[model samples]
Target: MSRDTAGTAPASASAARTGTARTGTAWRRMRLWGLAHAVDDLYQGLVPAVVPYFVLDRGYGYVAASGLTLAATLGSSVPQPFIGLAVDRFALTRLAPAGVALAGLGLGLSGLVHPYPAVWLLVLLSGLGVAMFHPAAGKAAREAAGDSTAAMSVFAAGGSVGFFLAPVLATPVLVAWGVGATALFLPPALLMAFVLVRAGRRRAALAGAARPRTGTDRWAPFAVLTAVSVVRSVVFSGLSTFVELYWLRHLHASQLVGGTALACFLGGGVAGTLGGGRLADRFGLVRTVQLGTALTVPALLALRLTPGQLPPLLFALLAGAALNVPFAVLVKLGQDYLPTRPGTAAGVTLGLAVSVGGLVAPVFGLIAEHHGPQGVLSVLWAVPLLGVALGCFLVEPGPADQREPARTMDPAGRSR
Candidate 1:
């Protein structure tokens, strides 16, 4: 018995060490993918930040400038479903690096061009590039993340971080060097692209040749989740578009205070995104999402009802956090529901449906114009209420729904 026990102890220790090492490696890969996600999304944020410079420097009117915005939006948000389909069909491992490069190059060259048509086209192409990155990168991030919602949130939060950093980083450069400074941003993209390529090779070498995907796709639940996501998007976009205006006009705050409020709200989104993932790991994906969606209504109502400047700021932070708690959860759940079509699932959840809010922004604009920011805020709670309703239909993916591990092949084509 003693001899048998001694032999088993070392073997158990070896297995434990192996598991720990694998977990550590998985996290490191997730961090790299997260950084790549940040770099890709930084370009998304750059579009809005650079739009003002185009108006100031090139003397473009609001209409022409809006066309530029439209170009980017149409390019990025549209066709993502198609791109995702292509990714799943072809296994496009190269798309991540290629997409980021194209996104950066298009934006970088847009400012250097002279014609309005050329600038619009470049921005459009840049948007297309952004579209290209999400599905492929999302699938890859999933492979890295496995079943951990917390790990996936790292990728999701990276996007929020990139969006947050864009104006901060690009504003000073644009102010100093005009729009031409956009050319300077290209190098980072190029460098990151190279890094991604190398990372892909290494991951492929470690993971080996891919195995056929396993699991059944559940579209009905995915459809419900999409509705929930769209509702979340509209609420988030509405607040993001008009939160500052709400502070300035309704709360009677100064421009600086308004900006600060917006900052607080966005910053809370970052924190909430991270927190939601952790919560999902513990409380479950569907529950976390439902909780977040339900909480958003009260938080937005509180933000609207709060009278004092200081109190509203707190509520804004809460509102932002509450609304975003499902942001990453939805993405992960979409993949869970459609395990066989992760790229397509990601394209719809991350790119296509989320864009609905942006398209719906004009309606919110009309509302603000007619009823003021407070009126817009009043209507926003109803949006998430609908999300809460839809979320009730969201069934968690079962253990059998989990994806099978990929089979690795040696250079000689033998399974390892």
Candidate 2:
């Protein structure tokens, strides 16, 4: 070979090594962001897990428990879109730490507060903290993951792990010490909030975004996606809110059995969220979502109708996986559908839109009050089928999208 060719080969090899190093560094950062996401969401899961305690120990009525759920749900979700819009204009990266800390602190105070109204206020504060974290953290995770659905899956799985851990970990402390044990759950959030504060110092994907597109909003697809997401929130949130009660009253189960049931469902969700990303990457995002939605009906049916506790518990795992596999993919798809406003997209999909389910939760409270917890759970069997019909209306972005750049940032944002 010529001397020029030999020299060029070494130079190319060096460039490859440097590129690989940068990618590796980015991935490590992404994992850390995932850890932050998990800790932030831990407080969210804690709200539901602690609900049973309020009902059983404190002798709170279904309406009162539902009111607490509404406060937390609305607090965490309603402010998200506005926060996303604000962060898009100016990166309030610090909001993430503040949000997590607020979530932890408010929840910690709940057990200490005596008045019912004050306790409700504390839960709302915690939910606001959750709302604060997602828009900023999600944009960071999107950048750090660099459009790798598998990496996004890892990030999404973190939240699932948090939700799964909430019941498993909280059940013991809560059972032993009552709702006042909420104070002990503060440490992880406090510590992680500091972790996020430091991590936010890193340059995020929004830093290297492309210029904004002037194209019209893709409201058609977005509306469909929102509808589907709302369905998911209702079913999943309903389950989280009621599953422990369902086990205790319906199946005559023990506390350990109850927590384990929740864990099985959420554990399945973690796996599904991770695997769903790969499935989306491999089979196409829309197709994978279709399968997941279709399966949700059968799994939930079996879970609801199964005679024995072990059998129903096993079905909960299936139901969790079938329902949640599309979640991370749906988030990514929303970014694609509205490429110009990815922050708003992230906010709606992650926060406001998803919270709609929680809005309807009081209806379930009424059902539980009148028809009982079994009736409430049984009614949810119809929700997944609606998701399926909605899925049918969604049009994929197309095969050409696979080879295009994955980062959903604008050129103007990238310059920052």
Best by lDDT: 2
What stretches of model 1 exceed 4 Å from their correct place?
1-26, 47-70, 108-120, 170-184, 204-208, 244-259, 305-311, 368-375, 400-403, 407-416
Q: After superposition, how far is residue 282 of candidate 1 from its true place, in Å?
A: 0.9
Model 1, C-alpha of 274: deviation from truth (Å): 1.4
Highest TM-score scorer? 2
Estimate, for each residue in 54-115, the C-alpha lDDT of model 1 and write its tens digit. 86699875456556656776887788899989988885768989989988999989999979
State the number of backbone clashes in model 1.
Answer: 0
Q: What is each predicted model's overall lDDT from 0 to 1? A: 0.79, 0.81
Query: Residues 163-265, candidate 2, lDDT per residue (tens digit)?
Result: 8889988999999999999999889988998777665554354444534433445779988998898899999888888888899888999988988888888
The segments of candidate 2 whose C-alpha lies over 4 angstroms from its true place after superposition are: 1-29, 204-217, 398-416
